[model samples]
Target: MDNNSCGCNVCSTREDLPWEGRGTDLPIAGCRFTLYPMTDRYVDIILGSLEKTDTSYVWSETDALSTVYRGKLPYVADAVKALFVNAYRSGVHMALEGQFSKGCPGDIAGDSLLEKDGEAPNAKSAEGIHFPVKCKLALYPMGVGNYIDDIAKVWYMAQDRGLEPTTIHYATRISGDVHDVFDYLRDVCALMDESAVSHYILHFTVNCNSPTKE
Candidate 1:
């Protein structure tokens, strides 16, 4: 692939091969945000908790649910929310929390590659919106060098079709609307080949809201 730059799904310069309509703009998910803490406390804690769980739990734990919950230690439903509160106070956005769940070694929840449906006209009739999207993201786990680069490629593709970048999180603060929240799950799943993950959870701090919120 050539290093072609893209802005809002279209090549600001010109539509080169693989550049025209290359990115699909999907609607953003509702009511979600990222956490960015300056000192990395939130991310450290979350990843630390996750690390506690053996990456190879499939060989040890028989119960799939238990294995996943173990990583989300102190396993509270508001695991991410709790982190967000702390991070928000301390000025952080380290977790990079997603809608679906952490793509830990064995997460299988929402494992299927889904497609995104644009914002509906009367989407406000319910508390949660399920985006039936057909999307695929390839992850080179150990290939750390260009993971960021590759993700950018996919990101642009999404943005082109109308899937906008909801916000950028850093030091615990966020800058996006509800749509971004909805897409968070898809973005996370796309970033990691989450199909292999056994079990997972996504925290919707704002209940009256999602599978997590409720």
Candidate 2:
């Protein structure tokens, strides 16, 4: 069993029980100490913010983020816009991608074209895009593929969320807006209902440019 599910008091209690867990004065590699009252304060601070909003709020330009979805997403629609403009005093064509990146197995996360002349990637290619605005989607799976077509009124389950995406990406753009990503998923799941596939995962984030496929 992985360390997280371990029921030992060390795993269940104080996480600060030192990364080097001890019992009878012997250190264990995966053992941990109980969470002392001091560390609980930090956990409270972090979780307290999560309970505040399901989405990012307008952050002042100077605030920092070591985590995403918990802290505010940098707002481009407000005074925060100035931060991005001022950051690019060097006259860049576009914001150079940052190192903060992750992806599913074999998923592409950046630009497909080489030097502005390379051929565009193919369908089923994993691609990414970034949106200047934030939009949320409440997606409900419609069975799997065409079998879902047999089920009436699946879209209505999602229609109530009031999200209309200006840019609809097939499977390429995995960033920017979760709404667009889910829209594509809503379409795909309705198509895959009869295929060999049983389930799929959709991942979305801020601006990532990699192609999802090789």
lDDT of each: 0.31, 0.26
Q: Compared with the true structure, what per-residue lDDT tens digits does model 1 show for residues 1-214?
A: 1222322243445545443433222211111234333453644744454443322211112232222212221121123323332223222223333233332222222312224223321233222423222212232322134445644554564565464433333111122333343344335444443332222233322211122221
TM-score, prediction 2: 0.20
- Quote model 1's TM-score: 0.26
TM-score of each: 0.26, 0.20
Off by over 4 Å in 1: 1-143, 161-180, 194-214
- Segments of candidate 2 deviating more than 4 angstroms: 1-158, 171-198, 206-214
Candidate 2, residue 60: how far the Cα is off, in Å:
29
Number of clashes in model 2? 20
